[model samples]
Target: MNENKFIQLLKKGDEKAFETLYNEYASKIYGLLRSYLKEDEIEDALQDVYVRIYRGIKGFKQRSKLSTWIYKITVNTAKNYLKKQKKNYLSLDFNLEKNKFTSKENVEKDVFDEIDYEFILNSIEKLPPLDKTIIKLRDIEGLSYYEISKIIDKPVGTVKSRLHYSRKKLQKIIEEDQNEGNG
Candidate 1:
């Protein structure tokens, strides 16, 4: 089942076609979910992403590849979930455990300490949403310019510029921190 046929099936309300599409991309979606939901299991997040995709597929337009559209939905949902978690975390009384935490021999390191793919992912999350999206879609996921342009609904030139800017910004952040540490 190719993208065009899958999209047509989605438009026509075919459950089997939807299942086929979900199965094909579930691993990619699950990887994104597992990264965002570090507290959760891969299978659990996979189920949630599929539920969201099923609910969301009807509103999808065909201008972008079905994969890109699905990825956008997955990322947006993850952001929303994170926001809610942050809000809940903030409401907790951290002061009660401040002394307890400080007394422990904490071993957490700076996320930017590494100079590899995981460090890159950590740094990318620190960037603005549009920039993060541009870098991830174009550089990490390796979507073609045409595909990213369609998914972002931006001109190809704009996508190219944003990607370049995002990479430069990340490089500057990492380099500046390293220089500061060594100095």
Candidate 2:
């Protein structure tokens, strides 16, 4: 069945619809939560999202598409989880400028000096929240600008511009690593 049919079943509280929805979006939801939450917190947050969907499905009003609403819920839920952790733990708004690596200055043990996909992901981890989300949604998740606009509740033009800027920022970070290597 199509998304609308599944949503109709979900609205009616059909258990089968829940299973179908879970089977379809489980990996996407898990990937999203994994990007933003700890491993232990993932399942809890995922459960919370579904609970919110169940209770709020009636009042959804269709202002946005179902998946967009789900994506927004996922992002909000993850943010709430992080906020609770911020009280006694690390500050999430970490500074990337302080962590820039210089290969020439720190070459004592060259075993771990190689730059690769995981290295790039580490650099992405240091970006601001919006930039990180924008890059992930556009590049990693492969969502289109229109869908991303709905998911983020931003104007389509704004989504396009931010996506462009996000990719540029990532590219610049990559270039920094290259220049550091060349130096």
lDDT of 2 by residue, 26-144 (tens): 77777676667777788899999888888988777776667778888888888789888773121122222222222221221142245465666666766666777666666556677
Please tell me which predicted candidate would have the highest TM-score against the true structure: 2
- My TM-score estimates for the predictions, one after another, are 0.56, 0.71
* Model 1 bad stretches (over 4 Å): 5-20, 30-52, 55-61, 75-115, 180-183
lDDT of 1 at 177: 62
lDDT of 1 by residue, 52-86 (tens): 77787778777777887777676666656777667
The stretch of ten residues in a row with the least summed lDDT in candidate 2 is 88-97
Question: What's the C-alpha lDDT at position 78 in model 1?
Answer: 66
Largest lDDT belongs to which candidate? 2
Q: Could you tell me the TM-score of candidate 1? A: 0.56
> What pairs collide in candidate 2?
none
Which residue ranges in model 2 land beyond 4 Å of their true spot? 87-120, 179-183
